[model samples]
Target chain A: MSKTKNFAVVLSAVVLVCCGALILGQKVNAAGEGKITGTVKLDGTAPHMKGIDMGKDPFCSKAHATDPGKMETYVVGSGGGLENVVLYITEGLTGPAASQTATTEPVFDQKNCMYTPHVLALDVDQKFKVTTSDQTTHNIHPLPNPMTGNIPWNQSQPPGAAPVEKSWKAPEVIPVQCNIHPWMHGWFVVVKGPYATSDSNGAYTINNVPPGSYTVTAWHEAAGTQTQKVTVAAGGSGSANFTFKAK
Target chain B: MQRNNLRKWSSVFGAAAVVAFAMPSSAQQTKYDFETRMNIESHVGNITGHAKDAKPDYRRYCVGCHGELGDGNGENFPWVDPKPRNFQLGVFKCRSTPTGTLPTDQDLFDSIGRGFDRSNMPQWSTFTKQERTDLVAWVKHFSPRWVGEKPGTPITIPPEPEVTPERIKAGREVFARVQCWKCHGVLGQGDGPSAATLTDDLGRPIAPFNFAEGARPKCGDTDKDIYRIFMTGLDGTPMPSFADNIKPDEAWDLVFYLRTLMSQHSKEKAMAKQLGLKPVDPNAPAGQQ
Candidate 1:
């Protein structure tokens, strides 16, 4: 009974301490642009998708134990496209953030019959040129849009594949699938933001943000959402790090 | 004592009965998460710990409806319209191709994360993805028929046909020859010859007019749509794909003919059934009735 009482008291104390720290932390932070970056990890229960038949495709056939591409995975890397993992301001949220519709061409390659960039982020009203690096035929199937219901866009990119890009003029979580292989899927996240994608090393830097009190949020395709207050001084890069837990 | 004997006989004959399994897990497997492909460690890790966690979840959110074993017959079974899925039985509908085969992880994910647009199944996206993932895995554990085969098989498909008008017309002629107009209604309204007799995965009659109808099934909504339908019959019901009888070209023609049926009843029946007013004439025939 005494141990139980002690455990209850300790739990209550921990809660109060966390709440107190949150309040003090919010008040002490001054306004400015802070950098937020960290590895977007996949921590929860993964799907029971059986191992794909590597048949004869070499790249996907085999690789290192940790090479995400080899594991029949959808890792949040350059290959994942970093789409829809929304990183925005959470608490201490202040003035609006910078944004734009840059119609840049992000390559959605199907090298060796796999959807490169398992996740990707794009600007709204922007046209993204997507092309396959594989010799197999591919189809760009954007979700939620009835217009391109399967997009009526299908083509084959032959070996030594010359780049054949398709533009996504509208914003959507379009899943670009290979007509050759049905299970292959990749995501295209389209948004209007002063947003920057995390690099291959799980790093992201959004430049030119005006100084203000913002709760920067980092979204990961698997680890879930992460939010923290960040202050950016004029023309200065503030520092912030987000850590996610895999349940 | 009699009940004990009933259990043994029951499992032998009605082993897959709808009322014998547990309620479905709220978490569904959707499109393969590109980020979190499976690791055997995670599979084993979760399985080791899943049983303990599964009990409470089943009791609190599922038992009242899905039954102790996930057979879709809890105490509240009478109230649910389409009844919860009988996981033990493993009959699933609404697959991309209409075949009632074992559901893909993504298919289950779609059902859990994004509740059916028109059904009573509620979306459990509010639950953590891990929770959802664990739940789906645990549900798969409910049935041991697939232990060694591995999970989530890739969906194979037919070769694409040339989408020219001539091919489309030729496809239509083949469609007529197959008498597809019978149950899917002449208009593809799913009211074809076998339409009225067709019961969905949940035991409800289903009509097949599917060109832009309420919500298109997960499979494509194109000529390829017909191809898959023809290849694998929709699971849980009478809609089998024609892979056995029709060639790819003929399947395409069936699709073209089906498209004509799509426009036939693509609108919602906003007028609630004025059931009391002039009951439909029985035996009057499909079109006239």
Candidate 2:
């Protein structure tokens, strides 16, 4: 009996050592992490973003009375920099960098009857929070293509409501809208690997990308997608800039 | 020897070719792969339902509206207002579970028997309990979600409390706080300020339920069902779950207030009449009413 037990103990040690080595091997491959950084700009004159009429909801109208909410379909910053474009590695990402799901939760906020950030880029299976900061009621409904394996859901966030935490199972560009406020619209750009959304100045940095050649794809809501190829060296950075023609 | 080896290889290749041709490509396969899901079973108490057992019943009844692939694209698709549910997506409006999760076997069982009110679906209570249980498994087999995911844990509903004038009034306060009137209207008239703009998951124009219309809710209209509706929410619609905001005790109070709004006579309505409970003041500052 003790001999059998000893055999079992030895077997487990072997299995543990093998599993640890496999995990450490993957970590070693994931070392020398680099990043991809770039700016996305509009090539032509930006379209006119119509001002929203929040007259339906008194609270929404009052909150934005002074500033006045405008459409976010095309938020072109100074120097024709396009905002809200998501950049992600569509190819060449492998091992831990490719399979790792982001643990940090991103917040998609509804404030003053408009979705904050306008476009939220997320890693597939990464948890995110939906929060409401307005006095009025808003339903956060993300409609994803059922074929993509990401199911659609509608949840209401009233004033002072607790945050709803959720995550997507697959990569899809889901259109989120509030049924109560038809003018409210946003996008949840879910991607498989490392991703970043273009900031106010159209700048983005996809961190923790182990050094490798990659095909980075930039996706815009209305302007469509563009791909660029780049290579990164150990402990260094790669850059890919994109310019989308405005409609 | 070379000739024998060639003959053996040819036979192997021939069998492989036959197998390949027998399997239908995904694009050409319009029917659901029922063979893989025939083993799916549903349990409602002691009743154990086999998906295989419901095929004949589904063909005779449900297939007319639910479709051959259970995609809700049956021949009756063009005639319906709010279209029949596409079981393939697995997202349902009636669920005891929270939003974004599969409904429990019992929830689906109840939905089949209760049917949807004011919609094309008629109550299928005529079917035996065993038949309905089998049908629940059949409904689930259409979605890959059943194979990959489990039904969400059903939300907890506290025991019913005695309805009083104060409880009814407190329910009104709960209604005001959540601003249910934004789409449901102050008097539950389905003509709230935001009602005109409301749409379902499909982007089709959908009207909020008018409690005064004398029509039963799409989900069941029982007291427990009403509590579950607001708590779990009608997914794929404008109605949201108040489970996060409304306490379990207060949920019962709101349920009673909603009872008063309904055209149907109820004990709560009789009590509200005696108490002179008025419609919530939508214009009242947040909690001042």
Best by TM-score: 2
lDDT of 2 at B107: 94
Residue B184's lDDT within candidate 2 is: 91
Residue A112 Cα positional deviation in candidate 1, in Å, after optimal superposition: 52
The parts of candidate 2 lying over 4 Å away from their true place are: A1-31, B1-34
Residue A168 deviation, candidate 2, in Å? 1.5
Candidate 2 per-residue C-alpha lDDT over B130-176 given as tens digits, one digit per residue, 9 for 90 to 100: 99999999999988888757899999888999888899999999999
lDDT of 2 by residue, A21-78 (tens): 3456446545688889989999999999999999988999999989999999999898
TM for every model, in the order presented, reads 0.36, 0.88
Give me the overall lDDT of model 1: 0.48
